[model samples]
Target: MTTPLKILISGQHGQVSRELQQRLGDLGELVVLGRGQLDLSHPEQIRQQVRAVRPDLIINAAAHTAVDQAENEPELAFAINARAPGIFAEEAQALGVPLIHYSTDYVFDGRKDTPYVEDDEPNPLGVYGQSKLAGERAIREVQGQHLILRTSWVYASHGKNFLLTMQRLLQERPELRVVADQIGAPTWAGSIANSTRALIERWLAGRAGAWGTYHLSAQGETSWFGFAQAIGEHLLANGKPCAVLQAIPASAYPTPAPRPLNSRLDCSRLAREWGVTQPDWHSALRECLAEQG
Candidate 1:
């Protein structure tokens, strides 16, 4: 007659939040808090909510995830991404609960044409990246029982992400112009959630896991243009509307935010440290695409 583990998860309606709740339901009692219950913008709410729940584990699935929008709303982004999670860590430490948090590949500047490891120097170019980097540093400063997973290109069936956007654009347009300069592994929210579960299971199995950062992107890499091409191919073959042509190159388009040219992440340490291996990007993408089928 063992009591079920009570896990308090933030970001009640986020992409990863939804996936994590569904996957971890069997392993614990999950209590989700939307912005109303625990807004990441307010540090006090994070502190108070974790203290009140007294959960065995705290999974912070919430984040200021809008990349381009963060540029105009630096204060809002910092409050939610940088400062709030630190407050969550403080309270989780007081309760002696493990905290699981997520980060992004934007922490890097994309100068090097190689996969970035957790130890790679972060040179964020935008407010979103800078704020997320701040949160990562703050979490490490606390030195509590915590795991920060840095991932990229997260999408799910429910959220407005790359997948849905591509689907819509391909259906509506005759031609597409995507930037090829930016590169990253397209990690599915479902896969990230499932991987988190496995990591937690291993932690509970008396495994010696490190409380540090890990590159949690999916296997393989693709430029934004290539990613869109792949999506278009899938949709066109599946009787869905798709662009007749997709042009690829960086000079073809530009944005207010200069994106990282290389979002490739090295998962060797992630595997060595967490004892987990992520599926290839194509495989994970195929699975998620089928999830909509």
Candidate 2:
């Protein structure tokens, strides 16, 4: 009989991690660790936990994702986003297992007018993006078997994300002004988890693609305003109070960390390489909301 795979995942409570727990249960024994069990800020703790678990695969889902907040605490961000991922790669390499790490589109400065491909030069505009870029480099430096999946505009039904926040505020407020200039795919966490499962299944079945970086996000693109407008439409369809959304330029909204005007990532590489693709942002959003209902 084939032994079930022992998968070790970090960030038990994160958006993607939560969905992964739900989606990957039938595949194997999932050892999902939260902050209390695996403090990513501590490199030794990460090493100890990975060594103790000795899993067949390691998924590093935890990240210091506070884009603006990271500016004030660069050390904490680097420790969690940069150093920890390298350590995970080291341990995974030691165990001779594949490592799957999530990255962000923020690595790009958003200067490009078109979608970003895998070979695109990363020019991070803030600390969070810089830290994430560092993490990617660290994993690559190990030269271990890894898949660095870079995603953009991640959200879920249960987590602290734009979807939940907008759902709450749209009902409570009469009008809301959302930035319209910044563009990206509002990728659902459930979609990311499902894609990850598919990728893992392919690898286990000996149909794995080239082990390297790939962009994993929903198809199509929209601004934050467009996403919020879509959310308002959903609320109105369900007979809930909806807010009046105003589209404003990115300059209108000054943030501690500047967001890219174009956060579009070319996920065609992932589709071509792994035979995996995601639903468009609108369809994915509908599926996610249906889950909440």
Candidate 3:
């Protein structure tokens, strides 16, 4: 008889964190640690707590994900995104366990028209992106079995993401101002969690050599305007009270944090290597909408 793997996940309140907890529930004995139990800002505490628990797998879903806010609060962003993950990695290495880290597509500048890959050179435009990139670097430098999975435009049934915001606006407002300039895959946390579980399962089956950076995103890409329109349409088609139209052009709205114009991530390597094909973004969103309702 084989023992089920013991896995630890951080940030239980966040979208990805919660999704992972639910997705990986039956696969192993899950030990969750939220900000109440662990603070990433205090790196020492991260190290100490993990050392005591000694989990077989450590999934890091905690991050400074507020893009615009990170520009003003660079120190806090760095503390959570970059510095904290380094401590987690170091402790995982000491325990001889595999650490799974999540990264963002914002690690690149919006200049490239193509989908960004794992080997691509990163030139983050804002503090949020830079901080996430720093965390990726930290994981690579650490001499441990680590997997840095880069994803983009993550949403879920819970939390205040683009889909939920649109669901509200469609009910309250007549027209929405959405930027059509940005293009990328809108990934659902539920979908990402499914993909993550498969990858971790493969890793547990004596495939630790595959421990490295890989891009895992949805299949399709669309602008925010298109995405919002689709959500509105989904609600409409499903006989829900939602009637909202979107206006394009980036000039309509501006923010302190600059987003990447191109957020499409090439996820072929992850699929080919581990047979982990992320679900289509729209399909995932529709499921999220149904589940949320």
Candidate 4:
């Protein structure tokens, strides 16, 4: 009998992590570690835990995702997002296992009018972006077999994401204003997890020829305001209370960390290389909402 792949994933409560846990259960011997089990801020702990797990595949889903908060705590963010991932890469290299890491589109400064490609030069606008970018570079420098997936505007039915936050605020507030300047795909965590599984399956089938960075997000793009409007419309259509969504420029809402105006990612490379075509953002959103019910 073929042995099930031993997969070690970092992060427990994260949207992607949770979805991965549900999706990858039957395919592998899945072991998920949360902050309680493996504190990412402590690099030594990360090294220890990964060594102990000794997985055949390492999927890093944990990250310091508090964008505004990262500005004030750059060291903590770097420790978790940058330092921890490098350690994982090193461990994966030592174990001779493939490492799967998640990154963000915030690496770009949003100055370009078009969607960002994998080869695009990163110009982070905040500490959070810098830390994530640092992690990407560190993993690459380790010369380990890795697949770094850069996604954007990730959300899910659970977790502290835009979709849940908006759902709560819409019910509480009479009217809401969302930033309209920032543009990107509102990718569902479920979609990301499923695509990841497909990639792993291909790799296990000995079809993975390249191991590098790829943009994995929902197809098409929308601004924050547009996303919120869609969410509100979806909620109202489902007989749920929704607030009046008003579109406002990013300038109107000053955040601790300057957000990229254009968070759009060009996922053509992933489609061309991996033959993975992501569903539209709207369709994915509907699935997420339906799952919530």
Using lDDT, give the best candidate's number. 2
Clashing pairs in 4: none
- The lDDT of model 4 is 0.93
Tell me the tens digit of each residue's lDDT in model 4 across 1-293.
14598899999999999999999999869999998898999988988888888899999999999999999999999998999899999999999999999999999999999999999999999999999999999999999999999999999989899998998999899999999889999999999999999999888887774889999999998999999999898878888898888889999999899999998999998888878779999999999999998
lDDT of 3 at 246: 62
Error of 4 at 110 (Å): 0.3
Relative to the true structure, candidate 1 reaches a TM of: 0.96
User: Candidate 2: where is the Cα deviation over 4 Å?
Assistant: none
Error of 4 at 244 (Å): 1.8
- For residues 1-293, what per-residue lDDT tens digits would candidate 2 score against the true structure? 14599999999899999999999999889999999899999999998999999999999999999999999999999999999999999999999999999999999999999999999999999999999999999999999999999999999999789999999999999999999999999999999999999999999988999999999999999999999999999999999999899999999999999988999999998889899999999999999999998
lDDT to native, each model: 0.87, 0.95, 0.87, 0.93
Cα deviation of 262 in candidate 3 (Å)? 0.4
Best-to-worst ranking by lDDT: 2, 4, 3, 1
Off by over 4 Å in 1: 1-3
RMSD (CA, Å), each prediction: 1.5, 0.9, 1.5, 1.2
Q: What is the clash tally of candidate 1?
A: 1
Q: Local error of candidate 4 at 233, Å?
A: 1.0
Q: Considering every candidate listed, which one attains the maximal TM-score?
A: 2
**Candidate 4 residue-wise lDDT at 262:** 90
Q: Which structure is stronger by TM-score: 3 or 4?
A: 4
